[model samples]
Target: MSVKRHAFVTEENSISCSQTEQTTVQKTETGSKFTCQQCGRSFAAKGNLKVHMRVHTGERPYSCAQCGTSFTRKGSLNAHMRTHPGESPYICKLCEKSFSRKESLKAHMRRHAGVKPFTCVQCGNNFTRKESLKYHMRIHTREKRFKCRQCGTSFSDKNHLKDHVMTHAGETPFMCDHCGKTCSNKANLEIHRRIHTGEKPFTCPQCGKSFTAKGNLQTHIRIHTGEKPYTCARCEKSFTYQRDLKRHDSDPFNCALCNKNFLLPTHLRIHLRRHAYARPYFCSLCGKSFRWLGSLKWHQKVCICAKTLLPEF
Candidate 1:
């Protein structure tokens, strides 16, 4: 029995060694035979080599079941499946909002905690995800790898590439049943439906202001924190809202004081507020009043004569 066991062990070792040598030899031969003609690159398997050929030939065999989106690989098809499924399995523990993938769920959680883990190596600008970091890095690299086939618009991300493709196909998969309005994407359709449903789930933590869109909620939060992201190119004056900066920069309403144009009518009205002699900003020193705060401040600074003025404006 001991002799038989020794013989079996020796045979198993010999077979394993032979198999390893065969694998190595086969890999070298396979690499040499089925290498890419365009890029001069080798793939491990013949199927992978065929798929790599699609890069040169611009072939997309695998198509989407829902919208007939042609893709190079099965993995892309699987990812695209989530769009139709609307089955967000990955749920954020912080907000309890479900996302299709783990990465998306992680990004969604970042908004709740205000975390930007990924930072740009060149500019030190922060992003919530590595994909966004990659997109930002492209700005430093000046690399636009993805290009649109229809209009030649370039993007840093793959999703943007796919979205551009939809423009050529004229495919709007997401449709509203209530109003019969079509949207290019499901996310857009959802936001459009909010107009009819009157649903504003995103609430500001600082203020009780609600927003139908998450992007709007994000912008509104900046108001409470006084974080102005948009800036004027001419004067370099920053504003909490893009519209505010645009109005300030473009001057649509034609300010009567500065003789400048403004974008919004309300901004021009506010500028008019400074000129109106309504005593909006009152002086506490001599119980005096002025139309503008600057005038009241100036009076308070050099108030020697008016010791006792009218109590009310």
Candidate 2:
């Protein structure tokens, strides 16, 4: 029995040794000896496996000196460093636009070539960039990963969440040069600047009417199509704009100062002017200012100057 046990142990050791030798030979041939223990992924170089391990380990050794932004790979760190000094090495030949990274230049070239390589499987929509497609997918998935802590408002996009958070803090970083008006984002500031510049870049094809914003142009196009997307749940009334639907559903506007309620926004605006002591309507004869047109007319009727001027006319 002891002799049989010894022979079995020897055979098992020999088999293990043969398998190890075969694996080493295969690694020598293929040049992929370095394998990740965590993920079981094979790499040709030892340095590559070490770098790949950082993903699982959550290690970011390469960090930017200027911004202190850490990256897993040295190549990514080098690419990010260019953004600090505004050093754009990659240049577009057609538009003469410079990009910090080669990948950005390639994406810009796709616009010139009219090439959309990345496509959505669900919607069949094509995008120039993979990141844009990923963001678009969140719409179909109804995934609201980014949520505002203050308002409990959820946004699918991270940048949208960032912009929404600024509203809670009352942080307006973007300032309009023309009006000195502050906006939450640069896009809003640009649109506000268009009021001064009269730059209507978005034009309707059917009506030939131009709008300052692309969203306004899209809404204008709906007028030709007769498409009312915003529908009231209670009244079943459809509206071209979402704001109209909101107004239809909303209660009478209440004044915060006087506790007065108004049905129309115009009436609310006039009422607010009274509270603010803003007498915009002026009497032509007396040179007196009144908050409302009715008040101005009543003042002109009793004015001595108006009575004398009326007899002269």
The prediction achieving the highest lDDT against the true structure is 2
Over 219-284, each residue of candidate 2 has an lDDT whose tens digit, in order, gives: 798789776656555545566786776676673666778655578888889889877889999988
Worst 10 residues of 2 by lDDT: 6-15
Question: What TM-score does prediction 2 earn?
Answer: 0.42
Against the hidden reference, what TM-scores do the models get? 0.46, 0.42
* lDDT score for residue 135 of model 2: 79
Per-model C-alpha RMSD? 18.3, 17.4
Clashes of each: 6, 0
Superposition error at 97 for model 1 (Å): 6.7
Task: Residues 1-313, candidate 1: write the lDDT tens digits.
Answer: 2332322231111222343332111123322344444445456665676675565555778898789877778887787777664656887776667778787887888877889998876546677888878865764454778876547788777767766666555556668999999876677889999999999999987778888999899778776767665555566556677677666766646665666666789767767866664677776655677776788878877787455553546
Worst-scoring 10-residue span by lDDT in model 1 = 6-15
Candidate No. with top TM-score? 1
Q: What is the lDDT of candidate 2?
A: 0.72
